[model samples]
Target: MSTATAEPAGRPEGAEDAQGAERAEGAEGTGPIRFGVVGTGWRSEFFARLARGLPDRLELAGVVTRSAERAARVRREWGVPAFLSVAELLAAEPEFVIPSVPWEVTPEVTGELVAAGVPVLAETPPAPDAAGLRALWEQVGASGLVQVAEQYPLMPGHAARIALVREGVIGTPTSVQVSSTHMYHAVSLIRHTLGVGFEPVTVTARAFTAPLADPLSPKGWSDDLTPKDARTTLALLDFGGGRSALYDFTDNQWWNPLRSRRMVIRGSLGEIVDETVVRMADPRTPYETPLVRRRTGLDLNLEGSEVRHITFDGRVVWRNDHTGAHFSEDDLAVVELLCRTGAWARGAAPEPYPLAQGCQDHLIALAVEESARTGEAVATGDEPWSA
Candidate 1:
């Protein structure tokens, strides 16, 4: 992987250098980048925090919400103006606008922003289905003002894992196993680690009801107890080059309070078993001795004993601690990169994970769903994984 050093200390918040700062300020030194946000919901809080933490790099110019009450609340909370209409938001001339609305509402709102040539950092899964995502992609491709806000791969722990993989610590990563109850979450991780290049070679799935009630279901949405409602899907993803990944997802796991999401990667040299515990067992040495351990918020260690163990604080592992909440240090590393590179803005060229990458992941997910429904092997095209 290419190595790029982060901007040194004393550099302006969003600029790479003095000249970049001048350009960012204005054509000849104007001001900071102004951001308008759409949707006032749980998701918006992440952006709110980012804006708050980096005032010079990101400024929350205004916000748009459907209800006046919610808009007023967000305005008071963030100390920024709020608008009920997209036109009102566009009039503010924000350099970028982040839409945190649901899939159903994203298309229309994104279209409005693209139509006005306003840059956008829209939330995922960009649309409800592939067609809608394609339409949004086309519009953004033509208008040059959209960047999908899929934050999963950039979330701290995952980002750290990606870095470790790139560093060859695992040695020729040949396969990965990911388990999560939510299909979307599982797919996001798969895509992040394997990239868009992974192809679904086979799928085996079974559905069963656990006879448990779902608290999140609305009154009318809970009518049926079909197996599909509580199911498990296992897929074999072939990335070619003898590399493969096994994906396991189970809705029933959600009902089990003790269950937790887990990901394991296997390679020729060693393996990373879990984010909470970093375990490396060299093939040459005994698995018991000379183990390496690195937990979150601690230094890495090379131990002489077999089966070295490292325990991370429950709060740090859960991502609920204030210091480790929402994003990790690794995640902040990527965010800092985005701020410095200005990749979050509309019309910017594609970065490591481009807009098309999201579309590809969606299509692969659709293929997985199809394979599971038909109980047959599904082969994907080369386009999905191509950068």
Candidate 2:
């Protein structure tokens, strides 16, 4: 293990101060929170972009990779030091460590970091299995350090849509329909928007083995399986407030390619549909209204408009001029939230998307999978799984 100390790089534009004990003592006003990242995969690049965007709030202290070649590559590409061991990386005393490694390695790697009293902003599915997830939660609890990161529900347009629903722009939300093929992704968004520990009254799932092809995968993936290509699941979730949600997952959706992953919500007064563009209903006129489709910048035209015919009310309005990736915007929102709320506050109150929320989403995902396997409705327990 090799340890080296580097001077703090000034805070990135719009960076917020840390909210930890050190900040209360007036340490945050001085510099950015040193952040050491573990893993150099695709997700790392996203975080790197975030770091670049918020240099004031976060500093790239170093990167840790298992292999010398990868470490060298990251150091050269990002212009930051790299370490081969966690201990070596920790020696620099980064206030936060982000683990973007595979789900299988999350339990072990994050467990060690939490035990060392290092806060973590880990990637999704902190563990591959329920047991691993539980163990990670336990370790985080014992360590007295915070572990939190939620990307799905916090995604840019989705978060804004959620706020709109909460504000009653869509009237009383009676039911929600989410169409997605990624089981974990859908569950995370559902759990985040509607609190955790929601029970499903009924669930019907159809599984078909299909070939999978993912160019990003190590095997260069494809979705052509021998038996079936996908599993479609429909779940009826009861939240006890006269609120219910219909969740759908289909492995094969030809139109999916045209739209960046989509989600639609229906309420008594109105409905919101998000695909390439985000469309909403006008609160006062009962007509469809168009919200800003994507993020603020990029190439999307901000002045174009489109109209769609819907069954419920009047024509749905959509805007084609919006530019930017909703996902990237969501990522920036989390960063902005972190800065505004201060970095050190524990749990969801201060963070909005806390470790507990992430854990809850994980549990719900497990229940979804379990319900699919057992062919029975799975009920969520009351335990608040936080770290």
For residue 312, give model 1's deviation from the true position in Å. 14
Best by TM-score: 2
* TM-score against truth, every candidate: 0.69, 0.71
lDDT of 2 by residue, 90-164 (tens): 999786788879889977778778777676777776677767766776666444354455544544455556656
Task: Provide the lowest-lDDT 10-residue window in model 2.
Answer: 1-10
What is the per-residue lDDT of model 1 for residues 133-152, given as tens digits with 9 covering 90 to 100?
Answer: 66777666444355565555
- Error (Å) of candidate 1 at residue 379 is 3.4
Clashing pairs in 1: 25-30, 25-31, 26-30, 196-385, 197-385, 288-306, 288-307, 289-305, 289-306
Error of 1 at 243 (Å): 2.4
